[model samples]
Target: MEVDHLFEIGDKIVYPMHGAGVIKAIEEKEIQGKTQQYFIMVFPVRKLQLMLPIAKMDDSGMRLVLNMTAIEKVMDMFRQGEIDRSLTYKQRYKINTDKMKTGKTQDGAEVIRDLMLVKKEKALNSNEKMMLREAMQFLISELELSNSMTEMQAADLLNDRLNVEKDAG
Candidate 1:
């Protein structure tokens, strides 16, 4: 969907690098002697605001939150531990970074899933650990809000799914 059609004030969106943010407003501004439109997003938890030029929204990879169907698919992948988990750290980092840069919710889900798996197997390096924590918190917050559940409940659901998968594998 086009960014303009997909986004509006009060809409919740996921920015790849920034996680979940709400659309605070859309406004016109004068930049470089031209009038331009921009989407203003507020990251409440982080206490930061991001402004993206409307003309560059798509290229910037701004995206809406996952729908119920997509959320379910992500949960299914988590439950089945479907992602390959044996890649080198550098390879894994590159892959997950690419996924995030694409602004695809499912890709974010995969990164969360894989990182959780890695965490289960062994301790992650500092950078990996930090990224995993950020991804998990982002996924949980968005899922909880979208699914109408508490964050703890959402996390419990993920843990239960991971436990089941660990048992099966």
Candidate 2:
């Protein structure tokens, strides 16, 4: 399969479950006598470099970072009310994890928004707390890139916006 090489070096992209990164290089290597293309991505959040095979990129849920307009739309999602909290934690976990796997900004916002509501109500189990932390960090990192703001600035803005909604509710 000839995969689309849509990403260029220096392009910022998001790898689901891994957060956002920049494409540092594209390389082809032969393994088992088969040559394949790979995108070398540098994730600032984890300070890690990964080689993602181009052919599998689409299936991996890798995507470009949200543009400013799309970021604004995601911010709007935060202003909306929380999702249904009737489900047990296990059920909620599955739904939220599926949203995270989509690598879509709005879906990510949903995960963050729902989890934030849960945190407000009571203590989250360790798993839920870790998920909240990861989701928040991912949102902050993407906001930094899309808004051209520093990490601290992005984080503060995110909290301020969410807090406003929290206070209103």
Question: Against the true structure, whose lDDT is highest?
Answer: 2
Q: For each predicted model, how many residue pairs clash, with residues at least 3 apart or on different chains? A: 0, 0
What is the per-residue lDDT of model 2 for residues 51-115, given as tens digits with 9 covering 90 to 100? 98888886898889988778877877776776576899899999988988888777888888888
lDDT of 1 by residue, 1-169 (tens): 2344568899888787777778999988898898888899987545689888888876877777776667777767775555466688999899888876776667777887788778787888998887777777667666765666776887887777667776776
Which pairs of residues have clashing backbones in candidate 1? none
Q: Give TM-scores for every candidate, taking all chains together and pairing residue i with residue i.
A: 0.80, 0.91
Q: Each prediction's Cα lDDT score? A: 0.76, 0.84
| Residues forming the 10-long window of minimal summed lDDT in candidate 2 | 76-85
Predicted structure 2, TM vs. truth: 0.91
| Candidate 1 accuracy as TM-score | 0.80
Instruction: Report the lDDT of model 1 for residue 10.
Output: 92
Clashes of 1: 0
